[model samples]
Target: MSAGGRGGVRATLSGLTTRGRSFLAAGIAAAVCAYVLGQDDLLRVGLLLAALPLLCAAVLHRTRHRVTAERGLAPARVPATGEARVRLRVDNVSRLPTGLLMLQDRVPYVLGPRPRFVLDRVEPGGHREVSYRVRSDLRGRYRLGPLQVRLSDPFGMCELTRSFSAYDTLTVLPRVEPLPPVRFGGEALGHGDGRQRSLALAGEDDVIPRGYRHGDDLRRVHWRSTAKHGELMVRREEQPRRSRCTVLLDTRAAAYEGAGPGSAFEWAVSGAASVVAHLLERGFSVRLLTDFGVTVSGEGGSGHERAAAAALMMDTLAVIDHSDGADLAGAYDVLRDGHDGLLVAFLGDLDGGQAASVARMRRRGGAVAFVLDPDAWTREPTAVPEPNAPLPQRLRVLREGGWTALGVPRGASLEELWRQADRERPGPAALSGKARG
Candidate 1:
């Protein structure tokens, strides 16, 4: 539902309690007067109170019909946890003036309380615009609703409410951070790297000649070999094989054991985003496999690259199976068939079984890399070991697996590791030789 459909001034004042409160006070006064005065005074007071409600109701009916409303929200698309401003315009459509009009725009529950404002006066055929800010601290789709306008009689004995349907939808996307450059095998993969691989396949071993085709570079023609063979000869170039990189993300919330701003899952997501961004930038086709049961295939071109990144961001907040002992192996099985590239796993803490799963993945022609968030050990370091801790043993198994493992200590940023990854990337000299060959 739109925000306009939620609570507004009209809705609040229209409540039976509000009207009852005013009527009860007037009744009480009449009762007090009746006790002090004679029966005749009580009868007269009863008529006055009764007539007051009718007179107020009449005034409300007259003024409410004259007011018209329009609603709008600026920058309709906002981040999931951000704020936006809404503008409401109320116009007096009739010749009569509208005085003391209360307006309330229906806001979604996710935005907290509905806002209420007052329109003191709207001259005949005149308009007054009111603006308020709303914040959405959570992610989702919200509808801003029917605008409500309220008018109360001058005597305050009665109230009338009018609602206008002004339908609008707002979509809040997930919050994203600037991902640091990620590297593979100490190689920096970004636009600045001239050594980035292309989709075109070129190698010395392939010598099969094919008929000349349109758009084929003239330098690739084998003129000498063509003349002897008496045919239009062109080099048959194979499509360049991209490095298949699969990001294995652990989505189990139980894996997140630590304190501070960075959780295990948060760090994992950041690392995954950075890695995906770097791979796409360097022309490596990347596929994402998350234990959250989300899979987005590798795509080419800048637009597809963006889609892949957004998919990752979307899955970071997606609901996962919270049941105890939910296996990561299920996610691995889903990605087992098609993944031929390096497998990078980010985990909270490892177990013997989980470690064995990583070993199985490595045996399937996938290079393994592990990012261990040490926050699982302890929020603050102490000499005494905590009970039921498996982090120490997990670290030991990871070290022996021949995997590139990095221990991310509590409060330590990933900037250094990112830089190190960049340093390990292949240099221009290597790329140039590969390209020329």
Candidate 2:
């Protein structure tokens, strides 16, 4: 049977508490014998005694006569460490008034303890509204329902309980911060290149003509000018060239060893946020990919920019499992084929096999930058006889394989690392000349 059905049975039996049932049986026996023996006074007394328990049950039931419940201010989606409001409405449908009603609503264990709400008195056909502001400090989905309503008699001899199924679900997303500025090695530091190139409009070059290229906006074609020149020409508009950069936030737990109080995943998220913000501020089209199966493609305009920022913040709170590293490979493959931007990966210490995979990405004609945090390998003091070597040696191996690798110390501020990255990135002039080379 359903819980509500069982609760209904319990409510019916609760009226016959041990004492109540005894008192009822005694009254019935006395009243029947008195009536047969023609004892009017005894019969009257027995009937009066029986009325007590019956009246008590009636009063208990009457108070809970009208009940209406509804959820209030339930957010469609909430972030971890955020709060949501749940509202319950109780209405008195009977002509009598109710006093001191107790209610308990079932909530997920992850949501902590179940809360109780009290209603002083509800007049006949009157309504009472109660609300609880619940806070979720963890990430995941929570189910709420099966409200329990209990009403007590004024004399406190018996209680009436009812159960209802009011199931609702809430999804909690991860809480993230604004993406900060980060630097990565590759083509021009602040110039746009690759698929979507940015051009600066100077007075001397209001409408310079360039050879037609694939993916160029057809609207930008200078039809009159093309006719005059007897060839197709595209209009050149001026905007600061934005570098193309991609950030990979590793979600592997194996990297968290010896990391600070927070998990390595948290640190990686923070690093990715910093890098994305830094690149976006410098006019670099930034894309973010996470091993948690989250992706935000590169966007150019201000609105798209805001979306990317929001995605970064949400990603921080995302739940990730490091059970299999295969997901990392899958995410990397998606990024490799779809994005032509400079690649920056923030990972835990790398193994030989993993280092080979990193090298494979670099060979695909993209500037690859790796930030390896040593904390992952140093969880236990005994785990690192030469813990420090793994990071530097891994970088050397990657560099030898033609990938740009940077070793970031555990606990180092993202701002400092970002500056170091900037120093290592090739300047626009340098890249232009490199193309010639």
Candidate 3:
């Protein structure tokens, strides 16, 4: 069938009920009998019954009530397991009263239950407001609704439904916990000039012109520099601060194994969020690297800039999903770009090649890894066959390669686990220029 024809049939069927059809059928049969046998009682009853439905249908078919809705979401972005209020204001725009109006705001399954309200009567040009709270224990972006409003006759036989094409979006960010007071001692907490360089880079601004050149915008001329240098000098724009930590999150699906919210993937996400929060709190510029080489960096040391960066990070993390790609080592090249800061990684399951790629970061400053013990988290005894070396062996390799690696067991307290300080290790040798891929 043609799409329009099918739609028309469905629309027609939705507005009618079996009871109405039965009544119409009986009325028609009675009317036929009355006309053939000249029965007055049957004729009167049939005409009255048949006219009732027609009258109801005519009255409802012409129903033209319009409503303007304004939706409000308090704290439009919330952390997982957080509550937010959804308020809706509906204004009637018809000349006559609308029949019982039923309004429901559609919500995604993850965002708790849908909010519903009913108005017995909406007088012409009147308005009503309703509010409800919604909470989600998971993270992601969700659409609140295209409001569904239904109007029905007093007898409930005839009905009309109109969906307002307006929607509101909700973003549920990952939960960030307070980091325990712990630092992997040694160069990981860069001392001396490294700290100074990090601070200086953080305070630097965007590139600006020191002296005006041809094709430069006249508006960019620095009046003070021109007065001092006897030439048209534009403010020099410099690059923003160099990020201090490259937070690489292993999103490769094969690395971690578990199910639902308790899976190793979620634990890795939480660990990443916690580490990012901790780095920001410690006044470090961070570059978030995920899914191989997708990098996100924030430039300024100012409070506003830091807050903006944190918000961006959380927003990005809220929507991160697992990748099917097995080789997550592609992020190493990007990590090699910055050599002055620490490298923090949340690793899932890993193969030898991937582990070796991660070890290359040792040439940089300090590298710390929070490795998930996938075997500990799996429920089935043989969820994954251990035909080769175990996860601890991989972590031992990481530790030997100048990384302060920690194996995280399932059901362990993140606060406690992260807080436990690692033993001091030798600093990485100074390596300049680009490292080979």
Best model per lDDT: 3
lDDT of 3 by residue, 1-437 (tens): 00011123345436755666666677888999999999999998888767665665555555533556778999999988899999988776767666777889899987767778998777788978889898887888999988887767676665666677778899998877787544443233323232222222333243233777888888767676677779888755443344377778999988877656668888888778877877775666778888578988763355787788888998889999988777765687776665556777888877777777777765455677888878777856556546664787788778767777877778666676665524444433422222222
Worst 10 residues of 2 by lDDT: 1-10
User: Candidate 2's C-alpha lDDT?
Assistant: 0.63
lDDT of 1 by residue, 124-240 (tens): 889888888777644456788677777655455555666786667765644444546454432333222233343234543346667788788988786765886897787665544
lDDT for each residue of candidate 2 in 1-437, tens digit (9 for 90 to 100)? 01233334346556555666766777898899898999999898888777777777766654544565555557846766788888888777767777567889888866768979877777777877887876676555677777787776555556677776666777666544443344344444546444443454454345777867888999889777788789888887645545567677776666555332255555665566556655565656777776554667655446677566645444443444353454368655766575555777877667777776665554222354546555533455455445455667777666655555677654556666555665665555544444344
Candidate 3: C-alpha RMSD to true structure equals: 7.0
Give the whole-model CA lDDT for all candidates, comma-separated. Answer: 0.59, 0.63, 0.71
| RMSD list, candidates in order | 9.0, 8.0, 7.0
Candidate closest to the true structure, highest TM-score: 3
What order do candidates take by TM-score, descending? 3, 2, 1
